[model samples]
Structures are given as structure tokens and as C-alpha cells.
Target: MYAPQADTRLLARALHAERITAGMDVLDVCTGSGALAVLASRLGARVSATDISWRAVMTARLNAARAGQRVQVRHGDLSMPWFGRTFDLVTSNPPYVPARDARPPTWGRSRAWDAGRDGRHVVDRICSHASALLRPRGVLLMVHSSLCDAGATLTRLEDAGLRASVTERARVPFGPVLTERLPWLRAQGLIGAEQDWEELVVIRAERS
Candidate 1:
């Protein structure tokens, strides 16, 4: 059962809206079901997508077949050894939930949720590596949660020497984010322990 997540589904649509041109070498990290990869391919980018889950890899391939596009899908972490090279445009829609987040009953067991105790584990790691993974002047488009400290994310990218910017933001319905992420959220004074996941931001950064 493919569950439709706001971040996942919304990411593909946002990518389409970004008007990414043809022939761009795009890398979709944490590819999950490959929605972003397939969409980028349709826009004429040479796409390479990867995920940490086997099921996600299969789903991505299947979805690509249904969409009549070819995307190189691989089962791997943010980057694999064989994925040895870099790309012109790197994008990731990674898990932003902290460990306290109650595992969603819907999401099939995948590392796509709960980065670490802070929810920035994988997010920070991926953003930190973006510079090495991207070519000079390459771009990185990523979507994460305000639940994950959007400011810190931007700071990390900047620390990595990438000029970062918030391209979009939206308020969506998130039920458990308030309950499960409350402890950490309140610890950071991010949430009042009464607020849920209402806002998400799509970030765009470039390798300078």
C-alpha cells in the first residue's frame, strides 16, 4: 500500500513547479518511491535516484515504468560507492522526524522517518555532504519540516559553504507531530507542546 505523504507528494509537484530545465544531471537522494526522480526525468533531466529501502527501490522502478520514463533507481543510502560521482543538481526529501515521533502506522518500515534524537541526523548529514556531491555552481533542492529546525538546516548548509534559501513554505495537517514530537519540540522551545506539524519548508541551496 503506497501511502500518500504530504512531503513526498508535494515534493514532486514542487519540483515540477520549479521549472527545472532539460539535460540537467539530477540526483534524488532518499528517493523513496521515486516521485521526484520520475518527475525530474519527465522534465528531461538525466536522473539518478537512490533509497535505503529495497521496497522503495522496487516501488520507484515500478512507478517509473508506469510513468513511461527511465530513472536509474538504486538501493542505497544518501550516496553509494558505485554512485561514486557527483551531480549538477542534488535533491533530497529526507525524514525530519525526531525519535520521539510515534512511528506512523501507515508508513511501511523505512528509514525515511526519524533522523535521530534531534530529527536532524540524516538531514544534517545529507546537507553537510551536499557540497561534495554537487558540481561547482550546482543546486540542491530539499524539503524538510519546521519540526526539524529549519533555521539550523539552513545554517548547516551555509556552514558547508552552500548559499541556502527557502524557496517555499506551507501549512499542512499533521496529527501526531504535536503529541509525539512534543517533548523535543518543547525542549527546543519550538512548539508549545500544543502545536502540531503545521508548517513545512522547501529549501534551495547551491554549491558555491
Candidate 2:
């Protein structure tokens, strides 16, 4: 199971800054461990969380129960379980690591961090579709690494007719995944030989 990390903590901090209120509808996509879901529930939002992994879904449900928070946990692709529904707020800390493979393992813990070659596999999906899942005046708070191209995300959200901007950012040292891929990433020129840090950024998009 994917445990809470810097990206998760950063997203939770950003959600707190959103000032989520009681009864506000909140959806947490790719809700690994349901860290964000629990945080939102604690803040009084009517929270729902979704994950493609059955393991993650069960883990999230258990975490919610252990935390004494009521969260609707769904098992499916990102946002798929919420079709025809709109939320006041949506938050995600999706897998944004640029992986060596075209897709993550079909059944493994790697699903929590492996994105396609450019790491935009899931991020692009969220950028293109999240706006459609939001109610009017709804806001989406998503966190990803700058290596995934934050500019592209901003542009995509804007193209989707949502006002988007980077709301929070934190520099974090390379975790095990990135550290393991350092050689390949350096060969690809995605990172310099001396680079050992990645900047995590939270993008906030609002639908008018």
C-alpha cells in the first residue's frame, strides 16, 4: 500500500488552504490510503474517495473507519464511479512519476507511482476531465511533480475553460523511486546529473 508522503502532505495543506466547509461535496481521486479523504472529512466536507486498486479502496475504507470519519469509498478508475455527478471540490495526489514502462504493473504496489514515459498518463486525464466533473464554481486541487510539466497542466486546464494556477509548491529530495531511476532519467536528459531534488506543485483550477 502507498503510505502518505510529501506529496500527500502538501496536497492536504493546500486543501486546508481551500477552506473546505461542512457539507461541501469533496471527491478524492486516486485515493491511495485515503489520506486526503480523511483530512477532508475531518475538515467537515462530505467526502468521497476513489481508486482503481481494490487494495487501495479497501485500505482507504479501513483507514476511514479507523479514523472515525465517514467517507464513501469507491473502487474504479479515476472519477469513473462518480459519473453524472458533480462535486463542489475535487482533490488528488495522483501518480506522477515518469516510469520506465509504458504502463504500471497490472497488479502491484507500483501502480501508486508509475505513470507513462512522460508521467502525464494520469495527469493529462485529470486535466482534461476534472473540469467536467465539477459543479459551477467548483474547484479542483491536484498535486504533482514539476517534472510532469506543470505548465502543460495549466495550459490544459485553461483550454478546458477553467482558470488554473499553481497554488503551492515544495521542494523535496528524491525518493526511492526517483533515486532508482536516476541513471535512466539522466540519460533521457529529464534531469541533470547533479540534480537530486524534485519540486512538487499543487495546481488549483476553478470552474466558473
Candidate 3:
């Protein structure tokens, strides 16, 4: 399971900032520990959460239970559990870190944050299918590393007829994963030779 980190906190801040009215239907995709899902419930929204990792699903469920929140935690790929159901809001902190391989890992802890090659493996999928999961005027809030091309994300969402833009951003020092892949990241022209920080962005896309 992916641990909640800066990206998670940032997304949570954005969630808290949102005026989530009571009974709003919220779905959190790739929910790690279900922190955001629980928070949504706390804000009076009915919540559901999904994660590719069974461990994460269980963890989220446990967390929600302990918090006395009613969150339906499910084990599934991003947004898969909610097919044919549209939500008022969808939030994700998906795998956006670039990895050496061209394909994402099918199993293991790395699946939580390893986006293959250009780091759009999961992001692109989210962009394409987001519209299907959103009710008209429903919103999607996603967070990822700027290294994965945030502009492309905006364009993709806009192309799908969603008004999208960066809602929040922050610069954080490289974590263990990025620090370990410095040479490769630099070689790929994803970061500056002397750079040690990465900018994380929260994108908000609204379906018309």
C-alpha cells in the first residue's frame, strides 16, 4: 500500500477547501489508506473508495470504520468499481512517478506510485475515463507530479469536454524513490541536473 505523503496531504487540503454539501456523492480512486474518503464522509458526503491493492482497500475500510464513517471501500482498478454510476465528485492520487519500465507493475508495493516510462500510464487512463464516472457538473480532483506533464492532463480533460485547470501546487524535495532515480530522471530530461525538488499539482476538471 502507498503511504500517505505530501501529495496525499495536498489533495486533502484541496478536498477540505471544496464546499462538499451534505449527501454529496464522493468517490476516491486509488485511495491509499482511505484518509481522503474518511475525510469526505466527515464533511457529510456519502463516500466510496477503491484501490488496486486489496491491502489498501482493507486499510481504508478499517480506517473508515474506526472513524465511524460510512465509506464503501472496494478492491478494483481506478474507477472500475463505479462503472455506470456517476458521482458528484471523484478524487485521485494515482501513480505518477516515472519508472524505468514501459509498463506498470502488476503487483507489489510499487504499484502504488510507479507510472511507467513517461509516467502517464495511470494518468492517461484517468483522463480518458473520468467523464464516464462524473455526473453532469461533477468534478474530478487529481494530484500528480509535474514531471508527468500537467499541461497534457489539462488538454486531455478539456478535449473530453471538461473544464480543467491546476487548482493547487507545491514544491517538495525528492522522496526516496525520486532521489534513487535521479540519474535516470536527469537523463530523460525530466529534471535539472542540480534539481532536488519536484512540483506536485492538483488538477480540477469539471464535466459539463
Candidate 4:
């Protein structure tokens, strides 16, 4: 399972900054360890979480139970399981790492972070559909690496009629995966030869 990391903490902080309160319906997409789901539950929101990984789904369910929070955990790709449902808040920390291969790994732990080519495989999908799952005035809080083209995400959300902006940013050292792929990333012109740090950003989009 993908453990909670800096990106997770950052997204959680962003979520809290939105001042989510009781009675809000929250959806945590790609809910890995369900950290965000439990946090939303603790904040008194009715929480639901979804993940493509069965292991992640189980982990999220167990985490919610341990936290004494009731979260509906579903196993599926992105928001496929939540058709016809709308939420007050939608949050996600999807796989945004650019992979060497054109396709993400079908199985294994690498599935947690491998996104095809430009790293927008899953990010793009989230940007395209998250607004549809939100109620009026609903907010979407998503965290991803700057390497994935934050501008594109903002534009996509705006095109979908959501008011979008980058709400937070932090420069962090490269993690193991990124470190291992530095050479390839440089060759692909996705990163500078000397770059050793990456910027993480949280984009908040609101439905009017």
C-alpha cells in the first residue's frame, strides 16, 4: 500500500483550509491509506473513498475503522463507482509520476505511482471528471507534482466551468522513484540535468 507522504499531508492541510464542516459530503479519490477520508470524517463530514487497488481499498476501510470514522470505501478506477453522486468536497492525490514506459504497470507496488509518459494519465482524468461529481459550490482539492503540468490541470478545470487555482506549493527533494528516473527524465527534457528537487502543488477547483 502507498503510505501517507508529504503530498498527502499537504492535501490534507489544503482540505482543512477549505473549512469543511459537518454534513458535507466528501469524496476521497485514489484513497490509498484513506488518510484524507479519515480526516474528513473526523471533521464531521460524511466521507466516501475510492481506489483502483483492492489492497488500497481494504487499507482505507481498515484505517477508517481504526479511526472510529465511518467511510464508504469502494474499489474502482477514479470516480467510476460514484456515478450519479455529487459531493460537497472532492479530494485526490493520484499517481503523477512519469513512467519510462508508455503504460503504467498493470500490477505490483509500482502501480501506486506510475503514470504514463507525461505523468498526466490519471491527473488528466481527474481534472476532466471531478467537477461532474461535485454539487453546487462544491470544491475539489488535488495535489500533484509540478512535473505533470499544473497549468494544464487548471485550464482543464476552468474549461469544465470550475473556478480553479493553485492553492499551495512546496519544493521537496526527489523521492526514490524520481531519483531513479532522473536520467530518463533529463533525456526526455522533462527535467534539468542538475535538478534534484520537485515542486508539489495543490489545486483547488470550485463549482459555482
lDDT of 2 by residue, 1-208 (tens): 5799999999989999989888999999999999999999999999989999999999999999999999999999999998888999999988888988887666788888889898989999999998889999999999999988999999999999999999999999999999999998888888888998999999999999
Native RMSD of candidate 1 (Å): 3.4
* Backbone clash count for every predicted candidate, in the order shown: 0, 0, 0, 0
Best candidate according to lDDT = 3
In the range 22-124, model 1's lDDT, one tens digit per residue, is 7888899988878888889999999998887788889999999999999998877677733568888887888777665444223456355766666787888
Evaluate residue 123 in candidate 2 and report its C-alpha lDDT on the 0 to 100 scale: 96
Q: Measured by TM-score, how close is model 2 to the native structure?
A: 0.98
lDDT of 4 by residue, 85-132 (tens): 999999999999998888888789988999999999999999899878
Instruction: Candidate 1: list runs displaced more than 4 Å.
Output: 101-110, 176-189
How high is the lDDT of residue 73 in model 2? 97
CA lDDT scores, all candidates in order? 0.78, 0.93, 0.94, 0.93
Q: What would the TM-scores of all predictions be?
A: 0.86, 0.98, 0.98, 0.98
By the lDDT metric, which is better: model 1 or model 4?
4
CA deviation > 4 Å runs, candidate 3: none
lDDT of 1: 0.78
Candidate 2 whole-model C-alpha lDDT, 0 to 1: 0.93
